[model samples]
Target: MTSADLHTALLRPAVLQILRAAGFGHARPVVIDTATDLAARYFLLLASSTAQNAFNTHNTFVPTIQDVRLALTQAGALVPQMSTAEEGLRDAVEIEGVMVPFEDLRGVQGFVTWAQGPVNKEIRRIAGFGDDANVEEIAAGLDEQEDYLTALKKKHSKTGEESRYQGTILGKDTELQTVSIIGGPAASIAEWTQQSLSTAQTATLPDADEPATPATSGISSAPLTPIESE
Candidate 1:
């Protein structure tokens, strides 16, 4: 979704209460939108991984609650780790009368409620009440074309002296010639593929005890023999 959609979803009254708790109540419009984007991105990863994890464990396409739990636990490990999201979803909810992970995807131990609480509650809370917060007053629409990207831009354009690459990265005396917020050089990297593929395809692997023999037009040099009838 666009930043505006995420901002609106996140600013819902229920989510607002949570965000308020997390220091978003009086936060600036940009800051709040940014946090919402981060959260939305994180949960997207969580949902995908969780669903995939469930199906993977069962060796079936249909995801079970146990899969949900296992996936949540595993995906949650990447909150600030291997995950792309800044904060990952929580893993392994404590059952009322069971020792943490109950393994079986049956009964009330289902992760439906566990997965369906807090954030979900707050999200649905806005819909249930029909009193979603008016984020228009919070700030201008985050969905404006190219607005957010421009906001994040910090140009230091000047044809002048420069510093070492490491020094520039560390914000030393000289300014950066350029820096990409999104990613690194793609065209250059794509060009780096090895040309040795031809050699590998054409080169003949000789028997350890025999001298090398090159093939002509990929045909074997073994002599043709007459077919023998059984």
Candidate 2:
């Protein structure tokens, strides 16, 4: 599938449903660009709304910085340990790797990365994990990164010009809603459902009345009719 298709697939109800299945209770899905700089851009989005959701939830959510790292872990994305956002941003700039550009995409588009380190590094390589890491890792990493950025932006308010800049970076030109507040899929709850059927069309012999097929004859069968009924 094309990168655009891949992007859309991440948000499909089926995928989000699977995430909820895997214990991510409060997953909010949003769609953004498929640019090489996805990492940095994502951080900016995270700083916007993702962070707010975290705090409003039960305090089980981690701090913004650690929350990103933990989000990587949950989504099976790679991340480096860093104590601060400043450190992370600098590292991102130095790597020259395509990541979501947090500063450029933030409220203050000019907020440059202060230094380089393990924090802002793009998830270049995730060694040892085979197969399942592909889509899930990207989705989880981006999801968490977006939340982290949102937290930062909220705590550190910016001037009107900066907000405008941030708005531009978030793609205001195309009538795009940069972020979407999404929900996880409901649980498989179909076990309790029952359906009516036409008896003539669905008729089958009672368990005792039917002869066992060769494949299943080795197993014992229960008495088809209840003793009380007899």
Candidate 3:
């Protein structure tokens, strides 16, 4: 397709207003033109990516709505919340298993809404990220855990320990373990608080296994040993 097709894909007025709102002055023809070109390329790239995703999923060029949604999520296109946030996207995009009209997809607002809410959940689930978690943070955490295990292993090897259990970090019952899951010291503190509490409680309680003997009368009646001569 020619550059005109890309240019036509942009809503020039919307772009100009967006720029003005962002404190930019004078949405000149040159700037608008450049912006339009980039925006068109972005949409085209999204479409291309979505199409490829569809093909990969079904081994066919024809893409389902689910495929397109997954592609948009992978590209981070579904995270931005639009002000309009209109709802009718699901109905518009999927009319009894047929794809939304290409003309409809050109409307950015509706397209954005199409990939949100329930749709975004599917995207996250398909991409293996939960709604409450970020993929980057999860990966970084995994990397940190791996590094911790590696360092601990090296320390063990240097000291000639074969089993990791010999050097495993201990845990606490009432609080998080002192074992480092972060970028600080990795030494673990032996737990004594819980044991101490248990001991204290037991010491205070009356023994159920044995009963106390009744108090004897105040009379001294006991066997006596003979005194030896000096």
Each candidate structure's TM-score, on Cα atoms with residue i matched to residue i, is: 0.31, 0.16, 0.30
Cα lDDT of model 3 by residue, 1-230, tens digit: 56575346434544554465455787568988788667766887888988898888899889897677667656666554322234434344557898763232333455545644555564444333456654456556752222223444466565554443353332123435465334523233233555667789999998788897677665645656699999
User: lDDT per residue, candidate 1, 1-230, as tens digits?
Assistant: 78666556634433445575444447676765666666676677777876777666766657775555555556553122223132234354567855452233332334445435454454333333222433342245543233212222223324322322225422345544543234533333333233345457567665579876665653455677899999
All candidates' lDDT scores?
0.48, 0.40, 0.57
Candidate that scores best on lDDT? 3
Query: Candidate 2's residue-wise lDDT over 1-230, tens digit each?
Result: 78655545443433433344345566433422232236444554555433554565545444465454434333333333332455456634434566643332331122223112232232211222223334345546642233323444455655533565355432235454433324523222232121223444356545777787665453356546556753
Clash pairs detected, candidate 3 = none
Candidates ranked, most accurate by TM-score first:
1, 3, 2
**TM-score top scorer:** 1
- Model 3, residue 218: distance off in Å is 99
Candidate 3, superposed: residue stretches over 4 Å from native:
1-6, 9-11, 20-25, 79-230
* C-alpha positional error of residue 135 in candidate 3 after TM-score superposition, expressed in Å: 29
